[model samples]
Target: MFKKIAVPVLLAVSGVAAAAEGTTTTGVDLTPLTNSIDFSTVLVAIMAVAASLVTLYAGVAGVRWVLRTVKSA
Candidate 1:
């Protein structure tokens, strides 16, 4: 409907405006050794934490299911 078309239209207009800006037209300029710490290593650590939380939640859910089944029998 209108909602679906409106999103794309707005996105296209925003993209066009961004392209008109010289900064967006050209790629970002960055120098090497700008930071003391590597960002990639931080990202990997965050991902590992998120994965561990997911596994923990799944294990808890399974345990709850087993207890519920036992109580019903």
Candidate 2:
């Protein structure tokens, strides 16, 4: 009973508080590091390579299992 009422009230209060705060910004400059490249693209490429390697390993293991089963039979 208390939970349902309290949740809505709390949400309403927080919404009002956030609206009051608005979009305030502090003036901090990052112009010095503009020349240094963003590593986001490189990070994504590395993740792709890792995923491909894992898939290849799984595929090779499956092939080896099939071959061993055939030989035993």
| CA lDDT, every model vs. true structure | 0.89, 0.93
Clashes of 1: 0
Candidate 1 residues 1-73, lDDT tens each?
9999999999999998888774545666565546655799889999999999999999999999999999999
Candidate 2, 39-60: lDDT as tens digits:
9999999999999999999999
Q: How well does each candidate superpose onto the true structure, as a TM-score?
A: 0.50, 0.51
Error of 1 at 40 (Å): 0.5
RMSD per candidate (Å) reads: 11.1, 7.7
Q: Best candidate per lDDT, number?
A: 2
With candidate 1 superimposed using the best TM-score fit, by how many Å does residue 22's alpha carbon deviate from the native? 30
C-alpha positional error of residue 27 in candidate 2 after TM-score superposition, expressed in Å: 25
